[model samples]
Target: MGTRHRDEGVTMAERPLVVPNPNDPRLTRRLKGLDQDRQPVLSDVVVERPLTLYLNGQEIVTMMTIGDYPECLAVGYLLNQNMLLAGDRISGIDYDEEVETVVVRTERVTNYEQKLSRKVLTSGCAQGTLFGDVLEKFREVKLDRTAVLHTRWLKTLLREIGTLPSLYLVAGAIHGCALCAGDAVILYMEDVGRHNAVDKIAGYMFLNGIAPHDKIFYTTGRLTSEMVIKTVQMQIPILISRSGVTAWGVELAERAGLTLIGRARGRRFLVLAGSERVIFDADAGEDAGA
Candidate 1:
């Protein structure tokens, strides 16, 4: 994972919302190094571990992660891959730290031998993999046309997300994904791979009974096809990112009725898809003049 730092899971008590726990022991390792002059230097390197995921009795995939929120990652990966359906009832999620493996059991027996056969290597860090069925489901999803994004909320979301304490700020080598309602960030998740962060957010939403139609999905990484697909799978109408986007990502967003906002730095953003949903309600000098 090219990160000098890692994103961990935990909530900061001082902040009213959930943020990454940069202080966690398992997420980083202290190291001694030397500069060009051979001077002694100390640094914290983010740790990556292999976690194997099992759905029922079949092995799904093993992912490289920062080792926080294993259950979320497992469930999210299954959900995003189309192995787990929205109507499925999860009976239990069992994790074994000794082996770094998680097993998700559901009331419904599942099998995905065919879906697992075809895999596409994605641009996601830590070798993000996507199954073929994901796109099939993508075409079938119909997002809420009534969902909208206000400029004021977008501005506020940018400010709050930046100020929150995160492992990315502390360690330096992680990506983040946030689930927001209006200007409020409902949850913040981070990991070595942008895919993992997104998956964690998805898993958290499924586990918590959170609805996605009226929410905004924000990420520190670029808007890629994988990102677009995952957001559509979650059924979120507005996807905002401070980073840039890919042509394919924009195309997918357009096809899925997603309001994709990118290059959202400072007070400017480019809405490449679903522009009809923007309300442009922010005031002048702090606004997008509607």
Candidate 2:
């Protein structure tokens, strides 16, 4: 099932798998307060609430999110945690908004008892927790190294995502991740945490049967190992961020042969890994201020 509730933003929520609905009143709140100078001030703040996820009969994790895409968030969390295999057939996804709970049922006999016994923490905010040895699967993923990310496509992508009417621009405390095919965004998701944003996209992709080989992942958050692992898990060829990268993230990208780009804003970006796939077809003056 798709997002049960949605409202049109300036341009988001129009097409694509999903996009931020900044105009959705439930996602934010209007608070009345006074400034330091004794002036009346009204502020729009993001609404963060608990969302508990269940894979089959077992509880997976309870994530704090903006509460729009509960179904995607639930399924994506299980997949990102490696609790749900990509080949696993999902029977149904049940979401109950009143209790803030979502359950994902599968046709295959699902079990993660051993995997659940181990938990690993990483640098991706508090939401960056994973179960068992993700590296075991990480090592086995052979990314399509032949995929290319053209400089011209990168510039267009930066411009497209930056100008999007999103919750980050509407309110201050939020994170966004986009799934792009070439320079065009196919899905743009946002939430209280960057992990939630990316996971929503992952769930959407899985449900829609979208191929990841030629896709690029973009994020407003830092390039942490969590980001690298999630992008690699999706089998996307390129990962770009308008923020800096962590050391472990770069190491993982190098190992996976994933094109990792960071500090991508206004015509300046650094490719720390898999530079062989970047085709520099654009000049410095072309979209220089993007």
What tens-digit string does per-residue lDDT give for candidate 2 at 185-254?
8899998889999899988877766777778999999999889998998888899999999999999999
Candidate 2 root-mean-square deviation in Å: 4.9
Per-residue alpha-carbon lDDT of model 1 for 119-182, expressed as tens digits? Answer: 9999887889899878999999999898888887887888889988788887778999999877
Question: Which pairs in model 2 have colliding backbones?
Answer: none
* Candidate 2 Cα outliers beyond 4 Å, as residue runs: 1-17, 284-290
Q: Candidate 1 at 147: error in angstroms?
A: 1.1
* Residue 186, model 1: Cα distance from true site in angstroms: 0.4
Candidate 1 positional error at 57, Å: 1.2
TM-score of 1: 0.91
lDDT of 2 at 219: 95
